[model samples]
Target: MDYSPHPTTAPSPPPATGSVSGKAVRPGDRIFLGLSRGSGIALLVIMAAIAAFLTYRSVLAISGDKSNFFTTLDWNAVGTEPKFGIAVLAFGTLVSSVVAMLIAVPVAVGIALFISHYAPRRLASPLGYVIDLLAAVPSIVYGLWGALFLVPHLSGLYGWLNDFLGWTGIFSYSNGAARSLFTVGILLAIMILPIVTSVSREVFLQVPRMHEEAALALGATRWEVIRMSVLPFGRSGVISASMLGLGRALGETMAVATVLSPSFLINASLLDPGGGTFAQNIASKFSEADTFGQDALIASGLVLFVITLLVNGAARLIIARRKEYSGASA
Candidate 1:
């Protein structure tokens, strides 16, 4: 018998374990990648849809206006050739939000620092939990508090401010009710306090132990350590948190509607009772608005949406411009 009549096959080599082999995609990873990409696309589509709808409705309101939408002080859109404008509302909204940020950011940062670094270790966790709880309080509850309690209690302070700063005009008090832009700003600052505090506290808590230790080893005082090591590292996080608070202040509806006595005219005095904000104006007038009036409110709402988008976009751009922002965020 010839030996070539039958042959045996060799065993196959084991799967390669080289660097190129290590780069092979796993099935699970491919699935995850596809899911994430699809989710991002869905989000973009939803955002685009919302923008298109808001723009469409706003244009319908603006098309028949007899007055300049940007300059007119009146918001009377009742009859044919209706006319209205957001000038007063925009002024009030921006002023109130600016005041809120001015009051909230520094106070929030200080409170967060105390909770994260200055509070007793035994007390820190409980204090943080209580601060977080403040954020969960209902907006309507805050509205009631502002209307019933804060507005009445602020009269003395308003009087004092008017006595000293009345010449500036914005701080002038003309014996009107305390439901003014200044009052609304104070209420908004209190409302957004929890959000900024909680976010900043978390960021402060994340500061690397090594960074603090290095500062200490270099003979820095506690305050100096925080100033040099913590604040610089966490600046971006604080800015982001403040932006979140500002967004809350800008879009707040019920609290503002309850606290503010809205007027279409721009008052020089923030301590006066008459000033309108976009969200507050809409809430106060929507039920009584005719078809044209409702459309006008929609147009103002579109302006507010654009304002908020621009604010958040500006904040993101600011954060992105900081070289340390990415590292701090991580």
Candidate 2:
């Protein structure tokens, strides 16, 4: 009997040599993952500790005899009843930060655009490095420069604005003293400029080469290419950078205290020598504070903490949306 030739069956490929979805992990990866999780837990613990401490101290302040915490303008924390509120401080923070953003965001975007798209490579790197260096400079040094150099020089400019734009109200000056919210804003702008510029430059540089090339291929001018391709792509990054700058501006203590002569009242004109920020108030008084005063200061710090958290959260949401948009486009 002749047996028919058996058809050959290919041996199944050996099972994948490595770990499967349900397979045991290597000891090294497990250890690393454990360490990462532990570190994250530790970070959360630290944040909790800080929040608890701040809340504890602030409750002492708010629960004390102070008036409606939101409405009272008085900030005297050294009386029998120690009245204080963050209204002026909040206003000052918002005003100075807004001014700094107005000055810094445009200039920073321009500088970033230049470095990313316009400048020659050799020059661009060095300038970028210089700006990065500026960001590292100590706040105290900036404060000294603002007080010694900027304040004196700004007096003349203040006078000019008063003379020419007094009718505009915002630029009107009272007595030619440059130690006003405007001056503080200018100083804050200078301090935050490098930070915004560096971040914005990096973001702009991240625009896809293919997109830039496509724009150029379509006969778009270099500026137009940047406007259409780079800026829109980096809009989220720009907002984040601006918020970072705003954060710094809000918390800038020494420079603001050095430049601002705080008055309790709120004024519409940026030229008025009025207002105090949370950081400024804290720095100016922390060293001399009694227990209640220190508590009040901590309470003000709580307000700042809340504001910063809100800003950063908004920025995170904006970035998340942009990332989604980019993912969809890709």
Candidate 3:
């Protein structure tokens, strides 16, 4: 569908009328407007192309599959009977991301508020810079750190969780190396923290100073001021920041591959060395996979891509819903 906005025909300014507007079509204006409209059209074309490619490859791979594409537990789409599913991969991806959100969002919000509102004026800038620097560190470095240093140090804590929360089954650790969903979530949390904090900090910082002053004049305590004046204003910003972090967590590949032990089964034990995310699975399997296997991987990538699109769409709706009231940008 050609939904890109078309350039509207606007009458020339009254002072410039009676010229048939031919002479009024300034070359500079024509070039600029044409370029802008063309860019929009180009973007639409690119998006369409990507969707078409994913759909083609995914259909080719799944056409011969015998198993329920959504329910099957294993990925074996390259065999004579070609059976595969994204259930396990999707589950792990969501679980790890959920864990990351659970751990990261609160901490990120707190740090953001601290940097924007609580930190000394002189220290705030430097602290924020440090956080931004953390975000700049390449994902592979995080992967290496997670594998080489974090894995060994996590076994004891995993054992403790198993001992104390084993009855719940969810936290039950299998005494395996700490390459599990929880560990992956922790690494993801660290990796995403800087970005989330940076976004939230900017949002909170943009809250109208008058609002804060009004709250103070009304004798609101610091905590109460934030609760009543700051938080309400930045709620959308915080949501946006969290969504960005979730996006990063979802697409993270190298870090996840390095920190997780891949498997096809889904289990309740979050501290065990098993389960696989979409990105992790694709990266780990693609090079060694046959042609059909590659197609199957592309199918999984399509799913991830769709998931990302849905997440972003939802975030946009959420932000739009609250735009009228959020004073974070005021």
Per lDDT, the best of the predicted structures is 3
Total clashing pairs for each candidate: 0, 0, 0
Q: Could you give the candidate ranking by lDDT, starting with the highest?
A: 3, 1, 2
lDDT of each: 0.88, 0.86, 0.89
Residue 121 alpha-carbon offset, candidate 3, angstroms: 0.8
For model 3, name the residue pairs that clash. Answer: none
Pick out the ten consecutive residues of candidate 3 with the lowest summed lDDT. 1-10
Superior by TM-score: candidate 1 or candidate 3:
3
**Model 3: residues with Cα > 4 Å off, grouped in runs:** 1-21, 24-36, 326-330
Put down candidate 1 lDDT per residue, 135-220, tens digits, no spaces: 99999999999999999999889999999999898788977679999899999999999999998898788787889999999999
The model with the greater lDDT, 1 or 2, is 1
